[model samples]
Target: MNEMHHRMARTCMVYTSAALLALLPVTACGDATEDVPTKTVDTSALQPGSYPTEPRNVADRKPANAASIREAIRLAESMPLAMEVDKQYVYNQSSSGKIYAPELPPQQGDSVWVENFGAVIPGLVVGWTSNAQQREDFALGRNIDQTVLRFSNPDQAKHAAKVLSEDNRKDSPAKRDVRIPGHDAAISYVTEQDSVVTWMPHDDLLIYTFVTPGLEVPPDVDYVIGMTKTALDKNIEMLAGYQRTPTDEMPDLAIDTDGLLGRTLPVDDMNKSGATEGVYSPHAALHLRGRADVLKRAFDDAGVDLVADAGARVYRSSDSAAAYRLVAALIDQLDPRYETTDAPAGMPEAKCFKKSDRRSSRFTSIPQFQCLFTNGRYVAVVDAAQIQDLHQKASAQYLLLTDER
Candidate 1:
């Protein structure tokens, strides 16, 4: 079948909520009418060539003063629960739902099992298998958060890095917090400006988001991250665990991505690279060229009156799931299945929604909303001026990046 036809057929993958056989229909071999034996590929055996090799220079390199982090938690103790916020999204393509929490979870004291669902959500991209190492380190009270956040396992970390950097004009550096196992502990890293971003994992439903400034070291974001880490540690046991389970299961993800075209190398439609004994995709090279072309066209076709990619990618903004939920709202409008309407109040609306000059600057102008698309599989965020052009070109891009979304 042709790519467009395949894209349409994949919609069945997104909409199947009934029979189990229908779950991965596109993956089904032979004729649809044939009652063939189901073939299941062991994910673990997919090989490891797709992972990245370059080291992420921004992971929490050193541990913060334990006393300082604990102190930060103490300061946040009195913060009103009313100030806390939770945002959620249910992807129509893959029935797996996601929730984002801006406020730190409440905590008791020691012997804590404080699982930050928001922070945990980012790890879902690689299946949170790395957390197994963190869990072991957590039991031993070692710096497991550092290992997990550092992108230690080459295959998964590299895969994540490949997808993340696909649209790279540059990498923005930012502060990231890696949770310590037992005590109210954390490791902090001061990322090169626009160079580092956070990927908070929630079991397998990873949340690719950014952090808000608060406790900063030397009175900046670095210090704020430390304070936030400390606060989480102090209330470790007190913080609430989300009523969500972690898994790779996605339901009702019907999508017609055949029109989507990608510059990135094609690898299992998921955009995963380095599979099967470390073979690299020629597609990565293509992705880089494509990103440059799209960006150049965006500047020329639409005035670069306001530039966003110059800062952090909005998906890497304060709450990524929130960012995606907003995009989901737009996608829901574009495609009806994405109709869940519960977003956090005061949640900033998308900047491109309104053409008015005043409204145009409202959301996009904020640094919080600055985000970019990675791996062609993730959500794409365009500046206000480029929205129309993006919409015009979206179908092909969607097929290329998500191919099935």
Candidate 2:
């Protein structure tokens, strides 16, 4: 794999998908439809299973807004996220939908979560990387790292840096001051491999990075110090004043796409109509009826709002296979409460249920296969749109979750 993929392909990519027609009026949903030259970013440029990491923008570049965010997403969408998972490597196709990682990431899923800042997201450590070598080190559970963390504001971010620095200086017998970036900064070296963890306070964000090899790899403090200087130079502008949002259209998530039941590429795959739209993260209208609180708690735990009426239309495919594909992609990304263990007979053992709200319309309940399940985090779920079996249009995608390997 190329270095870029090594850096950017570290799990925690949140998969979200919907049917082509599930999302309507492309202008809505914050998608930019400007007529730009058509371009196909073949992933080969970055090596198999990876792409270039987004350059640091908030610091030197203009802060990103809704329009810019959409433009980037559109650009990323235009590219094909094809990885050569050919027969060479033996991938455990099962277990591809684990919501949280089994261990501290570089694992998958739970590696990247929204920063809680004060009380919201705890134990949430954000790391940024741009080097392929370093990327491999991180994924393999090594100490070499170069990841970025964003915050709502600069004050909170700087305070966080200070706290981190203070906490990490106790690793050595002779308590010495940790090396920080600037005179007004504090630093820490928690491990010998990670010589110094410098926190650079930039506009609207804080960058915590290290360039030193593991303490065991080399004790070249000079080299380590040089990297610290480089980090300070590149991230100087990233400190404070500029306030904006962070967006990386490239899906950094991982899932076993081959695990998808029908691995054979269908010539007339689900894209028969050139369907390019997939509804991901749409507000689901769940009827509470007498179970308002019960459903509300479910929705709350599910991290979505439960409404008696939904503003958007949720269309179900007439094709059972197409519909099955849609629901499968949804399960792969949404991580909904599909733990009812209610899969259909003869189908693979999956946690599926026919539980639907009373207000369910014909659109959601199309005449087709309605079961849903996915492999736990076995493979990376980069592109949901590509997974829907297009050739199997006439039939429904009645795939089953695989048994434990």
Using lDDT as the measure, which candidate wins?
2
lDDT of 2 by residue, 347-374 (tens): 3333233222334211111212223322
Worst 10 residues of 1 by lDDT: 128-137
TM-score of 2: 0.32
Lowest summed lDDT over 10 consecutive residues: which window, candidate 2?
Answer: 80-89
CA lDDT for candidate 1: 0.23
lDDT of each residue in 122-237, candidate 1, tens digit only:
33211110000111111121111111111223344444433432312123323343443342212223344211223332222222222223222333554335433443332232
Q: Model 1 — TM-score against the truth?
A: 0.22
Q: What's model 2's lDDT at 248? A: 44
Best by TM-score: 2
